[model samples]
Target: MAARPEIAAVIWDFGGVFTSSPFEAFNRFEASRGLPKDLIRRINAANHHDNAWALFERNEIDTARFDALFLEESTALGHPVRGGEVLPLLSGELRPRMVVALKTCKQHFKVGCITNNVVSMHSPGQDEVQRAAGAMGQVMPLFDAIIESSKAGVRKPDPRIYLMMCELLAVEPGRCVYLDDLGINCKPAAALGMRAIKVVDVDQTLAELADATGLTFGAESVA
Candidate 1:
């Protein structure tokens, strides 16, 4: 049996974790819209490299300014492809692996989410957003806190957001376990003494968390 995790709480990232990152979906949308990947790249400018949204989520750039930049570049990519489409395309479907992890981890430890996300993308959704929100509400009950760049105005790698989540969960940094898809996001958490996990899939993370707490998580019922 796998050992239990030690952290009083486990924090997860939203975009790449609970929800699918519309990476492939964006490519599909682009190809269908006749917006070549290169053109999209040019529109986003250095977003891919510097992670502009992460900065925006961190409130390093005000929403209007960020939207303007994205709109200008995207319009340059395709006049018909408005900046409004950005949110829909970037929101990916939830991964089952992450769901399993969330569902399973919730029972053993306090769970929370810390993510670098855009407010424009996440804020409005009577339709798509609501759909995504519904899905999130399912597993998210597992979390003790939910921290997002859009809402918190601080993104990952910032360290403050990590601390905020720990604060909300009422757990010390050393007693928290943070998981994210990006190595950079994990760096600060690990430095702060949280047991950090970079999620490639989920098996390795589950095993590690299990080991930390000396508990057997996950039976044949779920992941």
Candidate 2:
């Protein structure tokens, strides 16, 4: 039997894992706009690796440019949508269970937060990025490191960002476990030897993390 790897760190994805997924809000936005479900996702996926979403997250495109380009893409897909209409929906409510789990993880291992995020340009004073930072601030002390795509110039599924997180945590890829709600984001981490958990819900993910790291992360303890 293969010996179990010594898990030294736990890396988490901010948008989906720690908070509710923006995709849930995306669906609501689509329904409110009377567009087909997953329209935003389709528009995003259509561009994939080089999409407006990717560029915006990398800080290569500013908010106005992203808004125009995103509108164009949505229009091309037969739905005229405004980026302003979508940006607000991207910030999901933080889950308390995740916060508890994070605190528990910090007791036993190093924790890091990696997120694909866009620069806050909604107004000269406030935007989603600021709001997100504020929301995460409560648990910020628990994390050993926090990486944002807009600051890092790289996003998930690219492999480099995962390595960047590992480097920041001062942990080897083989000695870490990563949890993300998106399978696409988890793929590269697993490829680099990090045990990856695809979070479907708080319970399943915590259970999987326990299995991976041999740490008891039961919801009851955190609750």
Candidate 3:
């Protein structure tokens, strides 16, 4: 592209848009550690508490605690393994699709990355987002802002996190366009006046993105 299109800012999701789901992949690996496939699901359904990931994002918990607790949980559940098993998934499989969007955004307007990620790297079977800054997979190198749950201490479907991202980008929500694979998270952003796109497939999502954001996609570029 000759120059980035004109938009105030653009936000992209990490997992599905990138290589694949490191989150999903990690959970799958949990089986090797002797963790039941449903272990994570049950844990999330029950309390949403006790998990260091939540506290880590709000900046309440540190990396050490997050990692140790994860391992502890696994051992308690009869599955014991080191934390690094999760690292390969995030870095290796999570390819970058929004890189084009990021590149396009930065050329024209401000760009920010808003992801709900763990605050630090400590344990196994977790998305090793600490290296996200260098993860060419998600084109992390191109982001003007990278807000993951671990760092933000919050995940989507929470309006506060969306607003926080807007504030950090210094753009009004109306001027921003956000993309994620999950519609649940997009609802709040749309409600807040930020243009939102649910990225199901790269080309198709790009088409919707171009239409909604008014960014001119090349004739051949899929939405």
Best by lDDT: 2
Task: Judging by TM-score, tell me the better candidate of 1 and 3.
Answer: 1
TM, every model:
0.74, 0.91, 0.68
The window of 10 residues in a row where model 1 has the poorest summed lDDT is: 44-53
Candidates 1 and 2, the one with greater lDDT: 2
Query: How do the residues 133-197 of candidate 2 rate in per-residue lDDT, one tens digit apiece?
Result: 66677766689998888899988889999999888999999999899998989999999999999
**Rank ordering of all candidates by lDDT, starting from the highest:** 2, 1, 3
Query: Model 3, range 1-223, lDDT digits (tens) per residue?
Result: 3332445888877766654555476677766656677665443333344454455546676656656765665566666544434434454353434565556557677777777555343233334454543464337667877777765567766788888888888988888888887787789899989888887777787778767666656633323
Q: Which residue runs of candidate 2 sit more than 4 Å off their true CA positions?
A: 1-5, 121-131, 219-222
Residue ranges of candidate 3 with Cα displaced over 4 Å: 1-7, 30-42, 67-89, 92-97, 122-133, 136-138, 148-155, 216-223
Arrange candidates by TM-score, descending: 2, 1, 3
**TM-score of model 3 relative to the true fold?**
0.68
Tens digits of per-residue lDDT, candidate 1, 64-132, equal 676666766566545545445666666667666667766666777888887666665546664766667
